[model samples]
Target: MRLYTIETGFFKLDGGAMFGVVPKSLWQRTNPADERNLCTWTNRLLLIEDGNQLILVDTAIGDKQDEKFFSHYFLHGDATLDGSLAKYGFHRDDITDVILTHLHFDHCGGAIKRDGERLLPAFKNARFWSNEKHWEWAINPNPREKASFLRDNILPIQESGQLHFIKDGEPFSPNIDIRYAYGHTESMMLPQICYQGKTILYMADLLPSVGHIPLPYVMGYDVRPLTTMEERQHYWQEIVDNEYILFLEHDPINACCTLQHTEKGVRLKETFRLEDMFG
Candidate 1:
């Protein structure tokens, strides 16, 4: 199996929102907010190539939104979903599966696109995978998360007859195992993969970046921050004990980081591009 980092591009968000109650002095040193105090973050997706099965982990914020809607995020980057796929000699139609960690707009927006007056799955041939709990939560989103779960980007997958849900512990594919967490959102599925005798866990929103590895770095967006803290503790110990590679979804610079047992707590021990590990 081979994994590729599919960078969908970068966008800005209020640093205070991204870092929660963490003071500016601390987060600014790492992310360094702009004059407007908005920090840039990369919407990094993962692609898995195993024989004829080409599975995409998540789709970054799609381009189907209106200009006024996009003005809020300040999205910018040379990399695009189609361009990145073509760079690796593939196309949208070649994708067999799209495993969405959650239905948040920034994570699965690119899974569908606007075609004329109709909304449809961008990869017509792919079976879109999302867990049942997350699917139900997103479908009937509460007021707190309504803005993040756009109906246009979501309902289309189900209407297209391509949406499917996997059991929490069921294997999505031979190359990937499944783990579920509910702190960030309801039943967010994190894909844990076994390759080369080392595990790589996709830290969707539960741990968006290495900075979030700390227990208290929970995002303000999380529905249940305390539950998230427990989940993080469980995962962190497991990752360090097993030497797992953590794939970040919103890190501005680093693609993957590994954890180490620090004197104070578990912290980022090393950062490397996914390609660096392949070499």
Candidate 2:
């Protein structure tokens, strides 16, 4: 089994929103903000190459949104989903499975594409995976999260008859296991993989970056902030105990990180590129 890091691109989000109630004075040190208070973040995705299956975890924000819609988030960087796939001698068509961490636009936007006047699945051969409960929650979104769950980036997968769900505690692949967290969103799936003699947990939005390692540094966008903190506390201890590597989705600079139990709490021990570990 092998893993590849897929770089979709970078975009800006309000630092305050990303760090929740954590004051700018603290989070700004790690994720410095621009003049407009927007912090740059990368849509880093994971591609699992295990035997016949090539599974992609979380597609980044696709380029289908109009200029007005994109102006809100300053999308930058030359890296694109296609370009990154090509770098590894792969293409969208090669992906056999797509595991959406949740239905958020940034996480699943690239799952679908604009084909002339029709919206279609980007990876024609891939089965887009999203749990039934989260699927229902996303389609009938609450007022707070309605904006994040864009219908254009979603509905098309079901319309195309390619949508699949990972049952609770079910095995996704020979080496991958599905772990669910509800703080960020209902039934947010985090793929935990046993690769290269190490355990790697995909930290979707439950833990965005190394900077968000602190217990109270939960994102404001989470529907249940307290639950997020509780989840973090539970996961942090387990990660430290087992020495698991975390695959960060939104960290601009770091691809993977490990945690250590420190006096303050479980803090980031080291951050490195994915290749450094497997290659």
Candidate 3:
């Protein structure tokens, strides 16, 4: 099995929103903010190459949104979903499975594309995967998260008859297991992948960056901040115990990291690029 890091570009978000309840004085040290207090973040996706199945985890914000809608996020960078796939000598059509961590625009936007007036699946041949629980929550989103669950990024998959649901705790692939977390959004599935005698947990908003390893660094965007805290506590233990390599999704610089049980609590031990480990 081979894993590839797919760079879909970077965007800016309010640092205060990214680090919930945490003071800017603290979080800014790790994720420095701009003049407007917006921190730059990468929309990093993961590609799994195993046998004939090429599974992609989370599509970054696609280029379908109008200029007015995009101006708020400050989407800047040269990396794109299609370009990144081509970098690996692959294409959107080559993907057999597209696993959406959640229905958030940043994570699933690239799953669909705007074709003139109609929205369509970006990966024509890939079976898009999203859990039924999340699919329902996103479609009928609450006022707080309604903005993140853009219909243009989600509805087309089901409309195209290529959408499938993976049950919680089920194996999505021979070496990949699904684990659900409810804090970030209802039933956000994090893929636990086994590769080369090690396990790598795809940190899909669960732990957005190494800076978020601390228990109190939960994101303000989470629907249930306390639930997020509890989930982090539980997962951090497993992460430290198993020495799992955390594949960060939004970290602009670091791609993967490991944790150590420090006197205070679990903290980042080391950060490295994915190729450094897989190569």
**Positional deviation of residue 73's Cα in model 3 after best superposition, in angstroms:** 0.6
Residue 156 of candidate 1: its Cα lDDT?
93
Q: Each model's C-alpha lDDT?
A: 0.90, 0.94, 0.93
lDDT of 3 by residue, 110-220 (tens): 888888999999899999999999999999999999999998888889999999999876799789999989999999999999999999999899999988889999999
- The clash count of every prediction, one per candidate, is 0, 0, 0
Q: State every prediction's TM-score relative to the real structure.
A: 0.98, 0.99, 0.99
Model 1 off-target regions past 4 Å?
none
In candidate 2, position 225 carries an lDDT of 95
> lDDT by residue for model 1 over 1-279, one digit each (tens)?
888889888998888888777888887877888999998999999999988899999999998999999999999989888888998999999999999999999999998889899988999999999988889899999998999999998999999999999986779878799899988899998999888888999999988877677788878888888899999999999999999999999998999999999998999999999899986
Local error of candidate 3 at residue 239 (angstroms): 0.7
User: C-alpha displacement of 245 in model 1, angstroms?
Assistant: 0.3
What is the TM-score (0 to 1) of candidate 3? 0.99
> Model 2 reaches what TM-score against the true structure?
0.99
Q: Could you tell me how far off, in angstroms, the CA of residue 262 lies in candidate 3 after the best superposition?
A: 0.7
TM-score of 1: 0.98
* Residue-level lDDT for 197 in candidate 2: 89
* lDDT of the structure predicted as candidate 2: 0.94
